[model samples]
Structure formats: structure tokens, C-alpha cells
Target: MADSRSGRSDSDALIRVETLAKRYETAAGTTPPALNGVDLAIQPGEFVAVMGPSGSGKSTFMNILGCLDTPTSGAYYLDGRNVAELSDDELATLRNRLIGFVFQGFNLLKRISVADNVALPLVYAGEGKSERRRRALELLDQVGLAAHADKQPNQLSGGQQQRVAIARALSNHPRLILADEPTGNLDTHTSEEIMDIFTRLNRDQGITVVLVTHEADIAHHAKRLVRFRDGNVVYDGGVKGI
Candidate 1:
């Protein structure tokens, strides 16, 4: 873990990273940094698109931002808390409390009902089964999947499964939703549907969203775009999209 001066800067930004860097150690000692001197600030209610070629460090950036891994050097202040300084256990708790994640693969439990899958996080939080079931059904309704609450994951189409994943992500009522290639596996129409859901969540719920994608059209759905190249951010600006 990084130094905990409890050293922190006063920032109201939902996410603030200063000079972030991550380097991996390999058989040959160490590889080039996965992320190099990255500085970024994302405000609450913002939808950000991260784009880059393979190995451009976008994935690394996402991992760091999601608190799955720490930076080699730099400061990451998420909602005013310095993440780099948190212990592993503290990081897990913070992640469960404040970040919801959705990935390219739906990652739903195949054996469980859609409702149960959506309520899984609540189970970890020790909520009563009845309360979890109630919340899960409510979230399913929000995603227009209440009718499929008892359906098995394999019985649902790709789009619906992704929607379930989104519902599960929202299960914890996290402050930020981090999605990686969420539309990568879907058809164009399905992709749009997924993006529409994200748009609505950001617009109606004011949840900060950061998504990484390889598609330019998909990235355009976001209000802001940040492009990375060779471990450096080559572009950061507003987009014309809503």
C-alpha cells in the first residue's frame, strides 16, 4: 500500500488522480509501466469514456480506478478518500460500499434465479433474505426484467443478461459504476440498448459512470472522452454526445 499520512488533498471531485503510475514485475525484473503519469479528475454525475488500443494502459487505468489494484506511484482520491493508502481489507470494504462493476461477460451465476443473482451483494452485506429478495425484485422491475425474475441466466438473451448484470451492479446502490467493454459482446441493437440503460442511469440517478471501450461509436455515447496511448493519456475533452 502507498503512504497513509493520512496524507490527502481537499477535493470535491468524485474521482481525482494525480500522477498515477503502475508498473508490473516480471521474470526480467520489471516491465515498462502499465500506466505512466496519468492525471485525471471525474466529477459526480459525469459519464466518461475511456478509449485506447490494446496494451495502451486503458485496462490498467480501469483496474486502478476500480481499486482492484494500486498504483506504483500517484494519488487516487475517490470521493475525497485516498484509495492508494487503504489496506487490502479496507479497499475491499470501500469497493463494496461505493463501486459497482459490470464487465464484458455478464458473469451472472448460472444456477441462480435472476432475482437471486441481483440480490447477491446484499447477501454479502448480511441483509435479511426477505429484504434482499424485495430489493432484487425492485431492481429487476427498474430494468424491466421483473417478469424474468425467476428465469435462469441461460434462458435469457444476451441483452437481458447484461441488463441483469446492470441490475446486480446497482444492487449495492454504489456511487460509481465502472463498466469495461459492457457492449463488446452484443449486437449493434443490443449494444444500443445497453448504452441506453447506462445513459438513463447517469441521467436519472446521477451515478458517475466510467466505461472503457474499443468502439468509437460506443464511446461517443458518453459526455466526455479520454483517450490513452502507450500508457499515456493522449486526449481528454468533452464529447458532442449526451
Candidate 2:
């Protein structure tokens, strides 16, 4: 099926998949399928949400999209690079350079200062200490956490901690942002705030965002929505209000 878009340019596909399938085989030779022959295309600067009920394979899709796992079959082209062709180490390096991840739990180092937490990705990227600190401060400021950069995770509110997590995700200046229930831990108001931040980043920074969420209200914030059922995409379309 052809992926539809609203006046998108021809030369801007950030991710593409064809007949993507995933399955797991245990030691006992019991095989359970996860994804079944899915095809999708995501363009640059697009904000897309993958929504489904539990056990619907959307989680498996997210894992593959994030490069945290590989598909058992089919092809996945991420930023023009074939996922199946890359070595494990190459995939790790590609993930470090191209993907920024935000999880539901706000995965930050609990004992570190917010600044240090935000700098962790840069550290992995081999950024110098001074440069890491400088960039981390800039990202914290962007997320409105500069004033509290010295605080530990326990010192910040839920929303603030999630913001720090976001800054850490962005430290690599990745082309794609993969957020898996990023607002799951926040209150309604905090969730709205975080969603606003994501929307702004997608719009202003031209970052492609793939969000996995169960909430329709949360999914509405995305430009597009793709629903999964029975290990396959059931619907891929634009959100009603744009």
C-alpha cells in the first residue's frame, strides 16, 4: 500500500519498511509471531503515533523501529541505511547517531545531577567533558531545566524529570526521536506540557517523531496515526485535525 502524506516532498523519507515481520522462537521450539508482514514509510519531520491494545505487536514494531531489536524477516531502511545489513556494532553506532529515545519511566541516572544526566548520551558519543557540559546546559535550558540542573532526579517533579530525560535524548541531535509512552508517568497537566514540548520540537527543529501511545487524546497530538492489530497495521492515516 502507498503511504499517504499531505503535500510532502518527494525526497524525504526518513524510514521505510517492506514486508516487515518478526517472530520469536524459544528453546522448546515454540514460535510466536510478533509482527506479520508490515509495510510503512515515515518521512522527515513527521510526527506519527503507533497505537494498539496490549499484545497487538505495536510494541514489537516500536522495538524494531528504535533499532533495539531486529526483524526476523523483511527489510527496514532507516535514513537510507538498511537495518538488516548493518553489523550489531554498526547498528549501535547508527542508533547513537540517529535515534533519540524517551521511555515512560524517564530513564535518568538517579544519583547524578540533571546536567550530568543530560550529558550521559554525549559521554557515550565521546564528547569532551567541557563540551558535554556546555551542550548539556544548552539542552537543559531548552527544556526549561537549566535552573535546576544541579538537582538529582528525586529533587525534581515528575514533569521536570521527564524534561531532563528529553534533554538527554536530544543531546545527540538525532534525526529521529522515539518516545514510548513518554507521558505515562505524568499527571494530565504535566502530560500536556510534555506533549507541547514534543510538538514544538517536531515543528521547529524538523525532527521526525515516532510515539507509541495507548491514549487517543495523546495520539491526537501527532500529525499521523498508525494503528496495529494482530501483528499488522490496520490503519495508517492522518489525524483528524491535522
Candidate 3:
């Protein structure tokens, strides 16, 4: 996709942030900025893992990237459009069109069927019921969970529920996937299974994946790793050797 404002092609960075920072206000006082002057760029189809301990600011950065939170300073460019300049509705539309999010929790509704859960995003995007069902089943099939389409969330294992979440994230055919500790709730083998699906999506389908995980083993699955410390990015490089 080309950016009308900058006239940049798809070869340009899909996500770019310059000196990005965010701070939250507490009842006592203003807390320290969660992110402080971080600069980074992610190209299309790149799989990057973000790692940091509690209070390290990785989650804050991911929230900003996902358009779930606003930065207090600096600029974030998604597909060459400045996030700081977009209105709330524009941000919502951009998020729905260009980004998919997967969280550690399955976040499935117990009242809904697995296929309906996968189709949730489509519902928000104003898709017809039949079309939503079609897309949901196709995505479920991709994640190896088509057989469970008629089941409820409680009927599936943690891993299966997470697969349903992944299918939901793909419903809009988003260019970027922001996954926050996607395997945190799963066991070792189940974590591996989820990572395998992510790897296949990034490699075969050319989807850009930015995942935040505290586990070193989970970070290794990504081609590149970004480590945060004390509200700053201390490391950004290949996954090997920490």
C-alpha cells in the first residue's frame, strides 16, 4: 500500500516511531514515563519480539503501537500517517484496517460459539452475517481449529481458545499483528504450537508480527528482538545471544 501523504511505497517501513514516549498520571502524582524517547522502525513482514521485565515499558510501547493508547510526546507513523494527527474515529478506522491484536488471555465470550468468536472482529467491521461466517471458518481452518467451530469457549483447551483468538485477529486481513505475551497462559508444548502458527503466518503469508513476551524462549522464535529497560530501549538486534 502507498501512503498518499508521503507518497511512500509498501517497501518503506510499515511502522515508524521517533522519540516516542508515554506517561500516566496517578492519584499521588505524575508517574515516570513508561516509554522515553524510543525510536524504531519495522518493515513489512518482519517478526519482532519485545522483551522486558515488569515496569520495563514494553507493554506501553505495544499499546501505543496498537493505537490502544496515545503517546505524550514524539510521533508514530503507521503506514506513513502520523498517529498523533489522527482523530479518534480515524484512529479506530486505521486500527481496524491495518492492525490485528492477540492478547495472552483468550478473551473469548463464553456465550458465543468458537466460530462466532472468530467472527467478532468482522462484526465490528460491519460485515454481513454470512460473509463473517465464511471468513471465520476460513481463518479457523488456517489455525487448525475448524472442527471446534460449533463449540463454546469453555469446551476448548487454553491453546485452542488462543487459536480462536488468532483466527479472530486475522479476520480483517491486517498488515500488522500485535501480540502481547500470546503464549503466557500455555504450557511449554502448547507455547511451541502457538509460536509455530505465528511463524507460519509471518513466513508464508508475509504478515508483520510484533509480539511482546517476557520469556526468553518465546522471544527466540522471533527473527529480531527489542529489549527495554527503565523506560528505554536498551537493545534492538537479532535474537541470538540475548
Candidate 4:
């Protein structure tokens, strides 16, 4: 874990990574570095996109940022906290408290109502049923799905299911939203609507968003773009450079 006192220059950055590296031991006496000397800083309320070819380490980077995995070396300060040293259970708790994830697939339970699907994370946090229901309803309304609360996930269209997924991701009021190919399964129009929701969350609620995609058009929706190639960040700059 990277301590706050370790090479942290920007006092206001929500995410700070310096000399971050990850490696895995394979065959005898050989180690492969998934991320080699990666340095990045993401500010509060910023929308950043990570673009890369297959096996370029974008997925590994997202895992580290979301606290799902730890780096082999270097420092990562998330919201001013050094999460690299946290225990597995502590990391899980921190993830639940600070990060919301949106994957390409909605990943909702088939038999549950849209409201119940959105409330699953809250339920994991040990909230009471009534409180969870109230918050779920609030999020559904926020995502324009209050009318579909009673419908099961199977009953919804792809776009509508994604909206429910977005609402569910906001259930805990997370500080960071980690989206991996969030619009991969949607058409252009639906993808735009999803990006609009992400933009609103970042601009209106100050939530930091980190999105991973291979498509240049999808990456353009973000203000900053980080490009990865061959397991390294070849470029990290504004979307204009994409």
C-alpha cells in the first residue's frame, strides 16, 4: 500500500498513483509485469476514459483502482487512503463503501424486481428492508425507472436494464464509479443515454468516473483519456488527443 507521505504531490487529487507496477510469477524464475511503472492522477468529479487493445492492462488497472486487486509495487492513494495494505476483508469493506461498478452485462438477478435488484448492494451493507426499499425507490426515480420498479430484470429491455444497473450502482452513494465497457452491448443511441447518465453523476454529484473501452468514440465522452498498449500507458491526456 502507498502511504500518504510517499511521493504524494497533489493534495486535492482523488486518486494518486506513482510508480505503480504489478507482476505475476509464471514459469521458473520468470515474472511478467502486467502494469509497468504506471503513474496517474484522477481528480474529484472528473470523468476519465481508459482505452487499450486486448491484453494491454486496462482491465488490470481497473481492478487495482477498484480495490479488487493490489499492485506488486508502487503506491496507490485512493481518496487520500492507502488501500494497498488493507486486508482482504477490509478491502471488500472499502470497495463496498467507496466504489460502484458497472459492467457490460447488467448482472441482475433474473427473478428479482428492478427495485430489489438495485437494492442488493444496500442489503449487503446490512441496511434494514424498509430503508433499502426507500433508497432503491429513490435511485430508480433518479434513473427514470420508478415506473418499472415492480418488473423483473427479464421484463426490461437492454437499455432499461442498464438503467436499473446504473441505479443499483448508485445505491451506496459511492465516491467512484468504475465502468468496464459499460455501453459495449448497446446501440449508439442507447450508449449516448448511458453516457449522459454518467456525465450527470460526475457533473452534478461530484462522483469520480473511470471508464474502460476499446472504442474511440466511446472514449470521447470523457474529458480525459488514457491509452494503454502492450501493458503500458502509451498516452494519458485530454480527449482531444484521442
Candidate 5:
């Protein structure tokens, strides 16, 4: 199926998947594929939510889209690069450069200060210490945690911690942000706060934001929803209010 914004130039698309599929081999036998011939496209600056039941292939799809796992068959082109053909090191480099990831768990380093944690990706990118610290502080300010830059993640509330995670995800200035259940650990109030951060980033920076969640309330915040079932897309359309 076509995306809601038809006639989008292919070069402008941020993500493109063609007949993507993944299978797991077990001792019992080759089980049903986790993803079966899926096709999807996402445009830059679009906020899209993916929803599905457990084992519905949504997680697998996210993993593949994030380049943490490769598809067994079919193709995935991210930002015009063919991911299926990239070497392991190339894939890692591409992932680090093009995408930022946020998880349900805040995934913070317990011993590190908030600013240091936000600077971790830049460390891998070989940014100088001064540059890293400056960037980290900037991101902390962006997430409304500039005062907490000196504190550890454990000192913050769940909402504050997730905000830190969002800041860390944006540290590299990635074009796309992939968030998996980023609101799962938060209360309704905190969840709304986190979603607001996501929507703000999407709206202000033109960063493509795609999240996977089971909560309808959470998915509704996105402009479009793509529902998956039995390893295939069941729905792809704009939200009710457009």
C-alpha cells in the first residue's frame, strides 16, 4: 500500500522497505517467518506509529528498520542506501550516523552523570571531550534537564529519566528517531510529556519519528498509524483528525 502522502519523490523518503521478511530457524524446524513480505515507506519529518499484538512482527520490523538485525530476504533502503548489501561494520556505521533509538527502559548508565550519558554516542563518534560536553549540555537544555546535567539518572523521576533518554538519542543529530514503547514505563501524565517532546522534535527539527507501541492512546499522538498482524501490515492510514 502507498503511504498517506502519495507522489512523494523517492529521494525524499527517509525509509523504504520492499518485500521485507525475516525467519528464525529452530531445532524443532523452521518456524513461521517473523516478517513476511512486508512493504512500507516513510517520509522525512513524518510521525508514524506502529501497533501490534505480541509476536505480530512489529518488534522484528522495528529491529530491521533500526539496522540492529538484518532481514533474511527482501530489501530495506534507508535514506537511499541499500542496507541489505552493507557489511557488518558498514551497517553499524550507518546506524550510528542516520538513526537515534529510544527504548521503553531508560537504559541510562547508573554511574555516569546525565550529561555524560547524553554524550556517549559522540564518544563513539570520536568527538573531542570539549565538544562532547558542549553538545551534551545543549541537548540537556533541549530536554529541559540542564539543571540535572550534574546528577545521575537514578536521581531523576521516570519522566525526567525518559527525557534524558530522548536527549541522548538526539545527541548525534540523527535524521530519524526510532522509539520502541518509549512511554511504556511512564504514567499517563508522564507519557503525555514524553510524547510532547517527540512531537516537538518532529515538528521543530523535521526529524522523522517512528515509534512502536501497543497503546492506542499513545499511537493516536502520531499523524499516521500502521498496524501489523501475523507478520504483515493490516492498516496504514492517517489518523481520524488528519
Candidate 6:
């Protein structure tokens, strides 16, 4: 029964979008707007799920939230700073410092050891080699993958690989996690295990989680659900009775 409207004060919101819209250009001409007049506010330490059918604009909205794409018009603010106002370098730094990304593909580097792969983000942040290795091992331990740290990606099962991916995502100690179909490729049991990990992270660490999923059961893991249809949010409320 909580108010689901995006009318919360901007000063307290961790993420906010106002009148957001996006359009894609095709060879024929501009396509209809992928997103239209969307308004949302996500606070820190909350878990939210987004659901929609194909081409319903859920993916577009996630991309914009992740800073991988921009809205053609309107405003997006992250951590109290307007996204459009930051320079490219500043944006990159902000993203690195504030967000962690998890994807369906696992996205681990097959060429490296699991620990090294987890350490990749620290490398970009310019941590020393020994320090990176130490931190990577620590994260691997947190994910219950410490025993597999020296092994290559191919040596692990799909679920284990995804655990490594989750560990890697946490390497930078980001405050927010943006997960896009994180359990899509896993089997039902494996998917549940992955979701459990995410749930623990949110509950124990107070990290804000925003996830996109097509499955009702998966969306049920979140405390709040936001459903999109035809570039609009048709539902935004508690997950129960959805």
C-alpha cells in the first residue's frame, strides 16, 4: 500500500528519472519512442524488480539507468547529480564508484583465472597487483568460491561461473547493483540459488538492487515491482498479488 508514484523528494532519491523518453533511428526513419514520459525514483538500500514483455521498454529503461544509453529527452539523476551534466570522464568515474553490473551471460574472461577475472575492475581503478589479488580472493571467499579462485572459467559449472561473476561485480564495493536477466541462462534450481545470493547481498550489505526479469517467480524476489507496457509504467507497487 506504499505510494508508488514518482513524487518523492528528489533530495533523498538515489536514482530519479523525470519525464524520461527515448527514440531510436532506423533506416526508414525514426522509430516510435522506446521510452515515453517515464517517471521513477529509487531510494538507497531498496530492492526493485522490473518486468515487461519484449519491446515493452523495460530493457530501454534498464539501459538508461545503467548509463549505457541516454534518454533523448528529460532528466536522470543518480546519487543527487544530474546524469547529463557530468563530463564523459566524470560519468565513467561515477559509474565505477557507484554501480555494479551483472548480466545473463556471466561475462567472465575465459582466458584468466577466476581470481584474476574478479580482480579486473580493481585493475581499472589502479590498485596494485598484490592488493588486487588479495581483494579478489576476499570477494571469492564471500561468494563461497574461494576454492576455485585459481581455476579457469571453463573448469567450473554454470552456477559456479555465475558466482564468480557476482564476485567480480562486487570487486569495486559499489553501492548499487543493476542486474539484467541474471538468472536467465540458469536452470530453475540454479536460478534460485543465484537469487538467494542477490537477496543476501541486499539484506546483509544494504546495497540497492534493480533487476530486470521476465519471469514472475524471479520478480517476486524483489520487495517492489515495476511493470512496463508500451514504453510506460503500468504498475509500480508491492510485489504481492501481482
Question: Can you give the lDDT of residue 78 in candidate 2?
Answer: 90
Runs of candidate 1 exceeding 4 Å displacement: 1-10
Whichever of 2 and 6 has more TM-score, that candidate is 6
Question: Residue 95's C-alpha lDDT in candidate 6?
Answer: 67
Per-residue alpha-carbon lDDT of candidate 5 for residues 194-236, written as tens digits (9 for 90 to 100):
9999999999999999999998888888999998999999989
Q: In candidate 2, which residue ranges exceed 4 Å CA deviation?
A: 1-11, 27-31
Q: Please, what are the lDDT tens digits per residue for candidate 1 over residues 1-242?
A: 11211244437688889999999999999888889999878888889999999999999999989999888999999988888678888887777779999999989999999999999989877799999999999999998999999989999999999999999999989989999999999999999999999999999999999999999889888888888998999988765542
Can you write out model 3's per-residue Cα lDDT over 1-242, one digit (the tens) per residue? 11221444443989999899888999999998899999888888889999999899999999999999999999999988888899999888877878988999978889999999999888889999999999999999999998999999999999999999999889899999999999999999999999999999999999999999999999999988889998898888888877
| TM-score, prediction 1 | 0.92
Write model 2 residue lDDT over 1-242, tens digit each, in one string. Answer: 23565466533579988899998898988566789999888998889988988888988898999899999999999988888898988888877889999999998889889999999888879999999999999999999989998888889998999999999989999989999999988888999999999999999999999999988889999988999998989988877752
Error of 3 at 91 (Å): 1.5
Q: Arrange candidates by TM-score, highest first: which order?
A: 6, 5, 3, 2, 1, 4
Better of 3 and 5 by lDDT: 5
Compose the digit string of candidate 4's lDDT tens values, residues 1-242: 22322454576788888888888777775466789989888877779999988888899999999887888899999888787767888788777778999989988899889999999999889999999999999999998989999998999989899999989989999989999899999998999999999999989998999999988888888888888886688887778745
The window of 10 residues in a row where model 3 has the poorest summed lDDT is 1-10
| Candidate 6 lDDT over residue span 90-167, tens digit each | 777766778888988999999999999999989889899999999999999998999999999999998899999889
lDDT of 5 at 15: 95
lDDT accuracy of residue 198 in candidate 3: 95
lDDT of 4: 0.87
Q: How much is 160 displaced in model 1, in angstroms?
A: 0.9
- Give the alpha-carbon lDDT of every model: 0.89, 0.89, 0.90, 0.87, 0.91, 0.91
Models 1 onward score TM values of: 0.92, 0.93, 0.94, 0.91, 0.96, 0.96
lDDT for 58 (candidate 5): 94
| Cα misplacement distance, residue 1 of candidate 6 (Å) | 2.8
Task: Report lDDT (Cα) of residue 86, candidate 3.
Answer: 95
Query: Whole-model lDDT for model 3 versus the true structure?
Result: 0.90
